[model samples]
Target: MMSKIISENKVAQVAKLIDKAKNIVIVCHIAPDGDAIGSSLGMYHFLNALDKMTTVVIPDAMPDNLLFLKGTKEILNYSKYPEFAGELIEKADLIFCLDFNALKRLGEKMEVAIASSKARKVMVDHHLDPEGFCDVTISHPEISSTSELVFRLICRMGMFDLFETDSATAIYTGMMTDTGNFTYNSNKSDMYFIIEELIKKGIDKDEIYTKVFNTNTVDKIRLNGYAVSEKLEVFPKHKAAMITLTREELNRYHYRKGDSEGLVNVPLGIENIVFSAFFREEKDFIKVSLRSRGSFPANKVASEHFNGGGHLNAAGGEFYGTMEEIKERFVKILPLYNQYL
Candidate 1:
């Protein structure tokens, strides 16, 4: 049996909303990671089983690596179909905001639509300091992933009998990827028990791992090699390593969306380094991914400097301006966190 993490009252409130809702839409954060997509899709499947009309709207395109999930094709991308996505939000009777804290995390347009909608909102997430935008907020920073929270929430609602193969696969993917395949933020004994339950649902964990991590293209492999060999910079004094990828270099390698998935974690294998940062140049901003070992608070740096926040060990931020400018900002901020190193 799993421990009860959500309050019974909150569960009842969400249950009532789910029961009353006719048109339900699930939305995840911008730059949807594995957990974001996983929780959204997991909820989508669960809702489908309940015979509710369901739609999954993502702020942007998901990583190519994640398209294998059962319902990826049906997911509405706000970036690609703004009008349709907006219409779905407008028509939704209930909205499940998964894997994100603030309304801003939905990006600009989606945030506006969700905020203005008369639909009741429920937030299921594991991020820090969630904004009070939802009618019922299930925020647990200690949970490994939002997918795990979704699983727990379903069970609490007495809907565990509705768990099926596809929902199990999606939830397992979120738990696996968000923790870097059980590398970090996965120390709880209950996590293994949850995996046991998922396995009982006939989810082949090995196959899911293969599909997510092993199905990388040749270009992705080359991109990883170039990142480690050419762009990697180790600040031994700070016990930190940084990898930067420019748009031109990404184009050179024919970079796809998920090509740089685990690049930030590669340097942490070194004996002394405790921190790693990856900066990928996007069209308008530099997307920053920060990872750390031990008790280092990567999310603090992300929130304080880079306009982002997440878990302590793993976090991300975004920076505007040239790559060099962001690099300079990183250098300038290193001394503040030197004590943690």
Candidate 2:
């Protein structure tokens, strides 16, 4: 569904900006996934190729799973580099935001840096219509991943050959993860073409898959089992399922930060389930992930009830209450879903 309107000029405009800037910084949404990390790193590499002084700053801590990326170690943690990163952002000639539609998603730490930046801010993302928060915006909801947009930007500049193995691996991994391992939202033709390009770069696809999916530790496996067996709750008549995990359970199972990435999708494989939700207790609030099947629009549900939105089939929100309150909210809203079903 990507249109020809996203012309070479648009790509070149961003490239020319990067090529001309003195100091550049990259930022992604908090709780970054592969797309966020990959796009940021890929852009960082491209800018660094032009000898621009660039740094990737994340508002929160980087997940351990993503440390394998080429420049992951260079990602400045907000806690440690807040003042310095803010100073650099304030003085930057340009700033690039990747994978997120809004500045609020960068969280509180980097919010001021973003707001006060004298630099022109450019957004590259694959979400729905944005909030118009940037000087220049390139958004395409139909794209499978922001990493693909990163690849396109580089290729349009005729600098695709400058992509190193680590950069390619990161971008390819993001493409794979965001598309549900190439099974979701990816038309067969485009998926194959992208995979072919990545393969031609000599990326070890099998090894990357193993690292992302099969490299879980024993403790992580146990945590997954505990989450699935103990937390999963189904409302057969309502065709809904919910999985709730508390910090206590996480502690008992030795769960680290990113250990619960794909647990919410488990119940979606079940027949007759119209919607699925996952609730995890974080330090301050409860995180929610919502999924819909068939005709259900989970994004609507999230935005209306849970204060969040994403793709139609998958979305997320956060609540500042106990699990009981969250469950009550969902139960009260079940009748609304009947119309969709």
In each prediction, how many residue pairs overlap at the backbone (N, C-alpha, C within less than 3 A)? 0, 0
Report the alpha-carbon TM-score of model 1 versus the true structure: 0.98
Q: What RMSD, rounded to one decimal, does every model reach?
A: 1.0, 1.9
Whole-model lDDT per candidate: 0.94, 0.83
Q: How many Å off is the CA of 72 in candidate 2?
A: 0.8
> lDDT by residue for model 2 over 201-277, one digit each (tens)?
77888887777788787888999898888888898878999998888988988888788888888888789987999
Candidate 1 clashes between residue pairs 3 or more apart in a chain or in different chains: none
Model 1: per-residue Cα lDDT over 1-341, one tens digit each: 78899999999999999999999999999989889999999999999999999999999999988889999999999999999999999999999999999999989988999999999999999888999999999999989899999999999999999999999999999999998899888789999999999999999999999999998899999999999999999998888989999999999999878889899999999879999999999999999999999988899999999998888998998998899998898888998998787
Q: What is candidate 1's local distance difference test score?
A: 0.94
Candidate 1 C-alpha error for residue 23, in Å:
0.7
Measured by TM-score, how close is model 2 to the native structure?
0.95
Q: Which stretches of candidate 2 lie over 4 Å from their true place?
A: 1-5
Instruction: Report the Cα lDDT for residue 322, model 2.
Output: 91
